[model samples]
Target chain A: MIISVASGKGGTGKTTVATNLAFSIGADVRIMDCDVEEPNAHLFLKPEIEEKSIVFTPVPEIDEEKCTFCKKCAEICRFRAIAVMDQIVLTFPELCHSCGGCVAVCPEDAISEIGRELGIMEKGRVNGIDFAHGKLRIGEAMSPPLIRKVRSSVESDKGQLGEKNVGKINIIDAPPGTSCPVIAAMKGTDFVLMVTEPTPFGLHDLKLAVEAVKLLGIPAGLVINRADIGDDTVKEYARKEKLPVLMEIPFDRKIAEVYSKGELIVEKMPEWKDKFRDLYRQINEIGSVKSASHKEK
Target chain B: MKIAVTSKGPDLESQLDPRFGRAAYIIIVDPETLEFEAIDNSENVNAFKGAGIQAATAVSDKGASVLLTGFCGPNAFKVLDAGKIKVVNDAKGTIKDAVRSFNDGKLSFSDGANVEGHWT
Candidate 1:
């Protein structure tokens, strides 16, 4: 089963929950860090990357020779990446979405796509768990494409990894926010585990995230970190929404200290390992029920 | 020369909008005749990204040789520069006043972008 750990707000313990869950689940489990902009799972997992591949997105390159300054490319480009002013045609590679609409609309066929390096995808192993992540290049605004690339790479490698006779569980550590990148990371997962703090900001962002997952028609549960520090509003909201509170990691100085030192909570606490395993079991139960209902339909 | 003045309304009597990308309207005028056409920029005002570039394209498409606004960001500046559209920023008052300042050479042309991208 593919499960994604996500949160709407940054620093809400998505990486913490994801890495812990990966370690608890043991072999035949793969963890993918889809937070391309600032992937932090590696800091805790410390996977020895065995393979690396550069990720590229197609950006338009205009040919001045075959180009009639017809302005067709500019008119059709929703991104405004291409501008045609009289005799001059300029293309901003950074702004291009590489939708190929400009090339299709170009009467003179003046536009062609050139690969622009956006990021890198790395695959490795850590404590018997297959690890993969996408690291976006600094200043690159587009991350969904790279996130999709990392996800596809994981999916393609699943068969090879499955030959070990161990049950497969794909854990995705998604990026923050309810934006396109977050949605891209969470897409295609069987279950979504939303991590949040108990604070008001956390609850507010969690609502947004819940809405996002609901819109995607994905089953999601909540994991409230630092559950004792803030008010019970998050729990109240979850109750009202009929969403299950899978686990609550109370606000503890030791957990904070361990996390600050780049150490996994499961390692230092040891007891939390079973708790993460329980969290996985709850997700599996929910996944089975959802699939059963889906089959009924 | 054709000049584009970012404005809050469609007429010359309207206030000159401070924002270039999210300006409500862009009034393209022929300086000699003072005849102008106001193009709505509402579509670009709420754009999630690339608003400046979209606004620059709109102004360039309107055949404006100059842009008069309060500020121009890097992305818009690049597109404007590529289109050879002279940008005169920090212009205030109504659209008519901005046009008068341009005609009188009171508004200086900007050498580069005055504000960072996504100032709002």
Candidate 2:
């Protein structure tokens, strides 16, 4: 089963929950960080790098030689990446969606595609738990493409069996916000583990996230971090929304220190490993129950 | 040569719109005859992105040799530069007055975009 950890607000404990769960799940799981813009799961997991690859996205490039300055290319470009003046045709690669519409519409065949640097994706292992993440290039405007790339990489690697890959549980550490990148990470996952706090801001953003998950038709639960820091509004909300509150981690100084030192809670406390395991069991139980009801319907 | 002025309304006496990309109207005029046509820019004003580029396309398609507006963005400036359409930034007052300044040779073409792109 694929579980994606997400939060609408930034600086929530998505990385913390995802890393701990992967560490506790231990052998039969692979953690993929789909937050291409600022992937922090690797910081705590400290996975040893084994393989790396550079990722790229297609953007339009124009050839002036064989080109008639027909305005057709410009007319067909939805992004306005291609503009044709009387004498010259200009192409703004950054604005291009690489839809190839301009190339398809060009009567003179002047437009062609070239690869633009998206970023780099690295795969590694931490204590037998597989890890992978993508780092978007600085100033890259779009991240959904890279996030999707990371998702596909993990699923594709899972297809090539026989390398002691006895795992089917894929944990996705999604990016913050309900935008394209977050949706890209959460799409196609079996369950969504939403990490949040107990504050009003958390409740507001969690509502937004739950709305998004509802639209995606995915079953999601809550893991309340810093549980005692704020009010009971979040819990009240979870209860009212019929969303299960699976786990709660109190605001503890030692937990913060361990996180700051880039250490895992399952490794440091050792007892919390069992707690994370319990959390997974609860999720599994809820997932099965929900699916059974769907089968009945 | 024709000059295009960004305006808040569809007339020569209309207030000059500061932003070229999201201007309400684009008045294409001939300085000699003072004859003009107001092109409604609602499509660009409502654009989610690339408004400047779309505006530039409209201005160039109108065969305007110069554009008069208070602020122009980089993307529009790129298309205008490619079209060899001179952009005079910081244009203010009524549309007619800005065109008069151009006719009197008092207005100069801007070097580049004056403001960063305003993303919605």
Over B10-70, each residue of candidate 1 has an lDDT whose tens digit, in order, gives 9989999999999999999888788999999998888767788878878887889999999
| Candidate of highest TM-score | 2
The lDDT of each candidate is 0.90, 0.88
lDDT of 1: 0.90
Q: What is the lDDT of residue A202 in candidate 2?
A: 88
Residue-wise lDDT of candidate 1 within A72-136, one digit each (tens)?
88778877788777677878888788899998998988888999999999999989999999999
Query: Which pairs of residues collide in candidate 2?
Result: none
Could you give candidate 2's per-residue lDDT for residues A191-218 as a string of tens digits? 8999999998988899999999999988
Model 1 residue B112 distance off true place after TM-score fit, in angstroms = 1.0
Best of the candidates, lDDT = 1
* iRMS (Å) per candidate: 3.3, 2.4
Q: Look at candidate 1 and give me any clashing residue pairs.
A: none
